[model samples]
Target: MRVAVFSFPGWGHLRPLLPLVRELLDRGHEVSVVVAERFAAAAADTGARVLTYPSRFPAPVPEVRTAEDLAQVVVAYYEEAFAALPAAWAAFADDPPDLVVEDALSTAASGLVADRAGCPVVRAFPGFAGNDEVPLNGSEPEPGSPDLDAEHPAIAAFVRGLPDRLARLGVGEDAVARVRARPPRANLVFVPAAFQPRVECFDGSFAFVGPQPPADPPPTGWSPPADGSPVVLVSLGTSSNDNPGFFLACGEAFAGTGWRVVMTTAGHLDGATAAAMPPEVELHAWLDHHAVLPHAAVVVCQAGAGSLMDAFGHGVPVVVVPQQPDARVMARHVAALGLGRCLEGPVSGADVRDAVLAVAADAGVAAAVAALRSAIGSAGGAARAADVVERVAAATPTDGGSQSAWR
Candidate 1:
């Protein structure tokens, strides 16, 4: 079988899918991946033929301060990204693949391509699958407030512009709606069922496949300190590490506490800030999370899905300081699950210290982590995701629709 995969530019979106792509290749299927030029090299490492495209919009500004700011960022990103769909389809015009697999956020573009080619498309959720049962992007609706009948002005404007944006690509407004509303043959969710909000409501159309293991090997020359103090790993994820204040706060919180702190800046931290960190803290631009997670007694992070799920996989509790709405939702869920505590808004070093200490002292957190770890282990990570893909490809009709059991 020949498969084409689409993903957004961020590592959070690309990393989860690589393990599945590699699994498909190992099974003798031909795979091609379409992603931003920034991720071309990383995608190629999966052994899939890689196709890179350019975006008209500039990368999202890291210092997103408000929900409005984030919503605008989403609109700009999709507007620019979907603009590239025509060229992407033209590249495969002569030789279309059997199926299209894409991250959930890439639905607009990938959906258009699948519709044009008349092939079944699989939607993969690397994090939360937004539905009526759960709040979108981790935003909680105010209690006693009526649901709005109309979309937000910014969002409505973006929706209105969709037709003009993809008109050149032969995707009409109705086609776009169908792509957005049409359910996938298989909805591959990369978190365990226990981690999902209101998991009982979702039918078999969704598979609660657990987190994919890191495709890369563990970092070399890194070992846990032999000191008996507990280890705290701090990271802000790759896309949103622009906040030096958070890192500075962490340094002050754990300084001289006998606990070893390993912080990853993802190359966003400045030299002056790094030099100012306390001697008890070790700062690096990046480290193998899979290698560091096992030794961590508690994780201090921004609650990105990949990092949060990885901590759970290793049975380590977390103190989540979410920087975005989606991450705020994950952090809330973590606190609700008894797996960790959340620091919601602008926090300080003392806030970080208190949350970390609270999580460390909570015995229940350990038990919760252990339960989630077992659930994740049994959810069939990358291998199960591959099985679903193969099944969908075999069962889907060539006329561009799917007749899979889940559908």
Candidate 2:
């Protein structure tokens, strides 16, 4: 089978899909990854043919201080991505593949391609799967917030113009509905079923495939400090690393403490700023959390789905300082599952330190983390994802009736 995997530009979105793509290739199937130009090299390393597309607008890096700001950021992202879809579609049209696997968030482009090419589309959720029963993030939006109002001017305009946009691409009116619906014919979620919101409500259409582990462990020269202090790993993921103040707060929180802090600044912190960090805190521009996480007693992070799953995979409890809506949702799920604590709204250094210490000291938290790890192991990460992809590929219609494929 020839599998075409489409992902948004960010690491959080693309990384989860790599393991499954590589697995398909190892099984002797042809795989090609369509991604933003910035990530083509990483995708190519999976041994899949790489197709790159230009992202016209810079990926948004918002300081999500309020719900409204987050809403605007989401809207702006969709606007920018939707603008680039026509060109992205044209690139895929030249060599359509047997099946389409796409990041769940890349609906604008993927929906059209599936419709035009009449191929089965499998949506991969790098984070939580959205449904009517559960909020997209873990919680409901603020009342009257643009995030909840589909009729908000920006989203409304996008929806209103969507038909004409599809028409221009030679897609039928039925494709408009697929573009709006959240689930695809089949969906793959990277988290274990225990972590999913409203898991009981989901039907057979969703597969809880657990965390996709790295195909090959990242090489790292650093290890736990040999001084016998417990390690705390701090990261804000790739796009949200602009928060220097948060990183500094983490440094201060652990300063003079027995815990050793290892922070990945993702190169967002300047040399002088990083040099000024507390002596007890070690800073790296980037480190494979997979290599470093097993040594950590606790992870203080932005609670992105990938980071949360990675931390849990290693049985390291987390202290979440969420920076966005999805992160907030994942943090809530973490707290609810007894996996860790969620710190919301203007968290200080003391808050960060206390949450880590509290969760670390809780024996029940440790037990819950262990249980989740076992569940994740049984959830069948990459192999299960490949199985679902193969099944969907076999079921796709060759005729132009794929607009109703999800049904």
Count of backbone collisions within predicted model 1:
1
RMSD each, Å: 3.4, 3.7
Cα lDDT of model 1 by residue, 152-200, tens digit: 6877887787677667666678887787777677788888888888776
Q: Give each model a TM-score.
A: 0.88, 0.88
lDDT of 2 by residue, 197-252 (tens): 88887667788898875334467887678878999999988878888888888898
What candidate 2 gets wrong by more than 4 Å, as runs, is: 56-77, 80-84, 144-183, 214-217, 396-407
Worst 10 residues of 1 by lDDT: 398-407
Q: How far out, in Å, is residue 201 in model 1?
A: 1.6
- State candidate 1's TM-score: 0.88
